[model samples]
Target: MPTDLSPVDDALADALDDERTRQRETLSLVASENYASEAVLAAQGSVLTNKYAEGSPGERYYGGCEHADAVERLAQERARELFGADHANVQPHSGTQANLAAYQALLDSGDTVLSLELRHGGHLSHGQPYTMVDEHFDVVHYGVDPETGRLDYDAVAARATETEPDLIVSGYSAYPRAVDWERMQTIAEDVGAYHVADIAHLTGLVAAGVHPSPVGVADLVTGSTHKTIRAGRGGMILCGEERADAVDTAVMPGCQGGPLMHNVAGKAAGFAEALTPAFDVYARQTVENAAALADRLQTRGFDLVSGGTDVHFALVDLRETHPELTGAAAEAALESVGLVANKQTVPGDHRSATVASGLRIGTPAITTRGFDAAATERLADALVDVLDAPDDEAVRDDARETVAELCRQFPVYDGGAVASA
Candidate 1:
C-alpha cells in the first residue's frame, strides 16, 4: 500500500487518512460491512492489480497471466473448500453481479422468478422494479407474515405454486431469522424451479458452520466476499459441476470482462485465513454478540424483527415503539453519537426505503475487533440512549463519551495510517 502520498497526491491521500480515522473512531453496525484482514488488504493492493486475466484459470485471454491465473485458481479452490461446493466462481464484481450471472446462466428471458419482497428483506438484485432483473424477467414476490414478523415457508410454497416461477431466489438482506434451505429447495423442486440461494449476508457464518450452507441444496449459491467473510470486496457463485461452465461463461464474456486479479488475490488470502479454526470461533461469537445486543435492546423495549437474530445482525422494528421516529432519523441520531448503523424496512413498513421503520445493526465488524457480548450489550444500551431521545443533545453527548471509551477499549487497527507529509 502507498503509505506516503503527500508529495505526489496529497488530496487523495488526506481523504484516505480521514476515512481510516473515521473507521477507527466510530462503531460500525452495518450488516453488509466487515473489516478485512491486513493480509487481504495487502493482496488487493499488490502488483497483481496491473494484470488483466480475462478468462478462467488455464485459459486466459492475456499473454502474461500465469500469476493471475494462479491467484484466481487459488481463490476458486479455497472458496470451494471453505463452502463445501462442487464448483466455485470467484469473479463477479459484486453480489448483484453474481446474481445477474446466475440468472443469465439458468433462466431465459421473460422467465418468471420468485423472490422475497424487497420491503420484507430481499435484495434489490432479487428483482426489484426498474432493475435489469425485473426488466428482463417476470418477477413475483413473497413476503413474511406481518403479524408475526417472520417468514412463513408454507406461504412461500403457496406463492411458488401460484407463480409457477422458473427460478426461486432465497436468502435476504435484513431478515433476522434462520433460513430453512432444504424447505426452500423442496418448494423450488415441487414447482420445477431452480433454486438460487443468495447467502450474501451469511457467507462467513455459513462457511464457519455457524449458519447452514446452501451449497449442495440450492442449485446455485451466490454471496459477497466482504460482508461477513472479510474477504476481497467482490462476489462469488457456487454450483454443481454440471452448471460450472455456464456460470463461468455468464460471469466472464456474459457480464464482466477481465477479472480483478488483485481482488481475487485478496479473496485467496482471506479464504486461507477462514480455513483456520479461529475464524469458526469468530463466526460463532459474532452471532452470539448480535443476540446479546438484541436482548439488551429488547429489555429496553425496542421491538426486534422476528424477536431477535440468529445470525450476525438484528433488525429492530421501531414502528411500534417509536412510531414518529423514522429509521433515517434514528440512523442519523446514532451516527451523531459515533455509532454507525443503517435504516431498514420492516415486514409491513409503509414508508419508503430511505425513511423506513427499522434499524439494522450488526456485529461482524465489532466481533472482528475483538468485542464480545458484554461489550455489545453496552453499545446496545448506548444506542437506546440515542434513539430514546434523538433530539436531546445531552443524551447524545453522553453516548458519545461512552462510544469514545469503547473505541479506546477496542481499537479497529493497531496503529494509525501514515499520511503523506
Candidate 2:
C-alpha cells in the first residue's frame, strides 16, 4: 500500500515512506501513541472520507448519508457497549474537542472549573491559561502531593469547597497511578460541581476491565480513540440519557461541523476488534509490561513518581538519582539510540516544560508490538545504559544495536511492511 503512493505523488509518498521506515526502525515509548490494525488503517483511508455527515446517525444535514449513518450508528453502538455508557457521541475530532463539548453542555460561560495542575499531570484542555477553556471559564487548579507524587484527595476536596466551582475534571495526561473516581465524584457532588472524567489514556484498559471505569460514576466521560484504545484517531463522549441531546448538539452545531466519517469507520472496525478475547489479553500484557518496566528502572536507581505505576506508563523523576540529568537530555540520549519518549514535569519541578525534570515512558506501543515482561526489562536496561553514559558513543552504539535486534525480532507489521493505505 505504501508503495502505491509513489506513482501519484512522489514527494509526499516518499515522506510518508520515510516515516514508515522510521516507525519500523525505532522503539516508541510515547504514552499516547499506538499502532492501529490493518483493518483500521484501511477503514480510515476508505471512500467514507468523501462524505459530509454533519449530524448524528439517522439525521444528517446532507444527502447520500445512508452508509455513513450506518457506520456512525455502528460506532456509537460499539462505543456504548465497550464503555457501558447510556449514550455515546462518536463525532468529536479529538479528545480536547470532546472536552469542549462537555463544557458546552454542562457549564455556563463564566462558571468556575477545578482541575489538576498541568505540571502535576493535567491536560491543557482542563483549563490551562490562554486556552479557550481558560478564556471562557474561571479555571482553578489542584496539585499532586509533592512528597508522594500522588493526588491528595483531601486537599482537592478543600480546594473544591473553597473555590465552589461549577465543574470538576478528573483524569490526567501523564499521571502514573490509578484515580479514585468515587472520591472525585463525591467531592464534586459536595461542592455542587459536575464531574467530567477525561479518560483519554485509559480507554482501552477500562474497556478491557483492567482499570477502573468512570462511565457510570462520572457525569461525563471523554476520551481519544487512538491512545490505548487503538480505535483510529478521533474523540468520543459518553454520558447518561438525560444529557445525550445536549452533548450531541454541542458536538455538532456547537463546536464541530461535519463529522469525520472515515475515522468513524476506523473506530467501528477497531472497536469490533477490541471486543474480542485476544484484545483483553493484550490489555493485560500492556499493564504487566509497564509494571516490569517500572520495577526494572527503579532497581537501576531511577526514582519514579509515586515510586511505581498502576497504569500503562511510568513517570521517572530524574531529579534524584540523576541529579545533573534533565529529562530533555535523557530523552535525547535515548532517542540517539532509537528509543522514542517524551520529557515531562514532575511534581514540585521548577524546570520549564521544554526541559522537564521527568520522563513519561509508556508501554502501550511496545506492548502492541507484542513485548513481554522479559523483553520490556531488556529494553529498560538498554535505556539505562545510554543514560549512564550519554557522552560515550560506544554506549549509544551498543544501545542502538539492542534496539535494532528488538525491532527485528518483533516487527510492527508483517514482513516489516507498513500498511498505510
Query: Judged by lDDT against the true structure, how good is candidate 1?
Result: 0.91
Off by over 4 Å in 1: 415-421
**Global CA lDDT of candidate 2, please?**
0.93
TM-score on alpha carbons, each prediction:
0.98, 0.98
- For candidate 1, the TM-score is 0.98
> What tens digits encode model 1's per-residue C-alpha lDDT throughout 78-103?
99999999999999999999999999
> Which digits, one per residue and each the tens of the lDDT, describe model 2 over residues 358-394?
9999999898887899999999999998988899999
**Clash counts for the predictions, in order:** 0, 0
Superposed on all Cα atoms, the candidates' RMSDs to the truth, in angstroms, are 2.5, 1.6
> CA shift at 5, candidate 1, in angstroms?
1.8
Poorest lDDT segment (10 consecutive residues) of candidate 2: 412-421
